[model samples]
Target: MPVRDILQLGHPLLRAVAEPVADPSAPAIANLVTDLTDTVAHWRDTTGYGRAIAAPQIGELQRVILLRLPGRPVWPLINPSIIAHSPEKLVVWDACLSFLSIFMQVERYEWIRVRYQDQQGQWHEAHAGREDDLAELLQHEIDHLDGILSLDRMVDVKSLCSREEFERQFKANSPYGR
Candidate 1:
């Protein structure tokens, strides 16, 4: 598995709607999934935090997303789509691997239900509620597969803050802040 270079903003690949994986059990598809997992692991190890990685982000036009949930197993979603979304909205700070140095508040559903195929080509459904950051992360990566970026869903661009600023403010607002 190779650690593919992540495509940055302005790369045409990021804008193209990814093609569905025709054969999840195919060798090439399996390799791509392995590469994606390796890429996510590499990023997490290097940066100390990372949730998901999409094929487009790595210049692959295949609809594949790898998610690593906190305390859960690493999973792959092939050709995922949101089958249902909650009426309520939630604002979350989002940062992209492709768009480094910019963090923004994107509005997403409080809960989402998605359908996807596993590496073995089996279809499955998952539901994520408002309190589930893992669900939010999955949605974020799936957006990439659909040719959507966080910038497009930002509720207030001005509310965006640098990484340092976000951390500082978050900590300052905590109960520990004197």
Candidate 2:
């Protein structure tokens, strides 16, 4: 259960598209998912925050993402892709493990249809949306798999704020908390 170091924003690795997991059944991929799960849980325990984390965030150039949405068990997505999306958009103040202390408002589709494979090589599809916090988290992590960061999705550049400032000024109405 190694909690790997989460790569930061300026890291070159964070800016490059991650490769697909060639074999979902590979031991290395399992290890990578384990590390991601450990890291996300640790971050939540220490900061009382964190929902999902992508493999790329830990410098693994593979399309794997670990999610822990409210009231659900671990959802490991390998080579996930958004097959379709709603025209509706939801704006939220987003945060990331890559830049833990920073927050910014970003626009994401209100709902999306996705297809992904599990760690065991099983394929599945699901629709996610803002109603359950799945849409935003999925979009955020999938963007990581494609080398896109929240900074690049900002709806308003002026929406950038430090965690302290965000809490003091915008936390109440911030779409991130839900």
| Model 1 lDDT per residue over 50-88, tens place | 678999999889999998756778888898999998888
Clashes of 1: 0
Instruction: State each model's CA lDDT, in order.
Output: 0.82, 0.88
Note the clash tally of each candidate. Answer: 0, 0
> Candidate 2 on 1-178: residue-level lDDT in tens?
7898999989999999999888999999989888988999998889767789998888889999999766789889999999999999988889998898999999999999999998789999999986667888899999998899999999987899899998888877754555
Give residue 48's lDDT in candidate 1 (0 to 100). 51
- What does each candidate score in C-alpha RMSD? 3.2, 1.3
Top lDDT: which candidate number?
2
- Over 4 Å off, model 2: 175-178
C-alpha RMSD of candidate 1: 3.2
Weakest ten-residue segment in model 2 by summed lDDT: 169-178
Considering only N, C-alpha and C atoms within 3 Å, which residue pairs clash in candidate 1?
none
